[model samples]
Target chain A: NAGVTQTPKFRILKIGQSMTLQCAQDMNHNYMYWYRQDPGMGLKLIYYSVGAGITDKGEVPNGYNVSRSTTEDFPLRLELAAPSQTSVYFCASSGPGSNQPQHFGDGTRLSIL
Target chain B: TQLLEQSPQFLSIQEGENLTVYCNSSSVFSSLQWYRQEPGEGPVLLVTVVTGGEVKKLKRLTFQFGDARKDSSLHITAAQPGDTGLYLCAGGPGYSTLTFGKGTMLLVSP
Candidate 1:
């Protein structure tokens, strides 16, 4: 049902370059999140938005930016891509209910050289 | 830092065998969720155990939550080839963030 969709399944970037990771959901959920997973590590939150026009930094928000302009779209931006930023990025969305399950996107695999 | 520790970072077994993966933490959670992720795919929710000491079964898979809500386990009976994937457990302590485990990489041979 197009629960959560992320763009650019794979990407290679040069150091200091900037790019945006796009995420969209059709579930009409009010909560959206961005997370990154490193090799052999658990996912770390990058940013999150409770509703449109409201966003907050997460555990690992360094070198990342996010915007929630609409209920369905939340994009994560990397201002200066670094080698440490190379990882798999996931987008998730949930409803208003407490502890509701999050629907995850296919994830974006990005590498910086 | 709230962390979930998963036991035996990796596992390999043959079809028709049974295995169990564990997830443990020192903090009490309001609920826990299990997800299975295949190569190059996002994780799909397997089950959610909310109450302490709760157990649920889905086909060959069984999920159990600890009495203290600080631990959980996944048991697969008569495993099949399709069970090969990464299993992750996430704890939601009624917070906005969902903390996840390192994950168990299980390989079920045919």
Candidate 2:
């Protein structure tokens, strides 16, 4: 069903480089989120959007930015990639209800050297 | 910060054995979800429990929500090798964000 799709499955960047991770969903959900998973640590929210043109910072928002230009797309931007930014990034989408289960994308493995 | 604590960070058992995973939190949540993730893949939702003291069964898997909605449990009966994966529990406060547990890595060897 291609619920949630994320581009750039893997990437490597030098310190101070920049890149954008793409995410798109076909579920027509109203909420989208960006999260990073580090070794042994649980997923941490980076940014989220309620709907198109509505975005907000999450728990760990530093070094990352997100934009929700449409209901189907929410992209995450890295301004100046650092070693700490190396982690697996995941994109998730949910329906209108706040308690609805979130559908996650496969994730993007990012490496900063 | 609201946190979900999962017990037994790792589990390895033979096939046909039963196992249980627990997720606990001090803060109450409106709903909780269990997800199973394989290597190199995102987590897939296994089940969601909302009401307190609610029990939902999916085939050989059982999900239970605590009476106070602050804890949950996932029990697998006669687990098979296919069930081996990383299990995560997330609590939702009826909003956009969810607090996730570190996860339980299960290995059911055949």
- Please give the RMSD of candidate 2 to the true structure: 0.9
Residue-wise lDDT of candidate 1 within B1-110, one digit each (tens)? 66899987999999999999999999998889999999998888999899999999999999999999999999999999999999999987786678889899999999
Docking class of 2: medium
Please report how far candidate 1 places residue A72 from its true position, in Å: 0.2
Encode model 2's per-residue lDDT on A30-111: one tens digit a residue. 9999999997787899999989999998899999988888999999999989999999999999986547889999999999
Please report how far candidate 1 places residue A74 from its true position, in Å.
0.4
TM-score for the A chain of candidate 1? 0.97
Per-residue lDDT of candidate 2, residues B1-110 (tens digit): 78899988999999999999999999999999999999999999999999999999999999999999999999999999999999999997886588899999999999
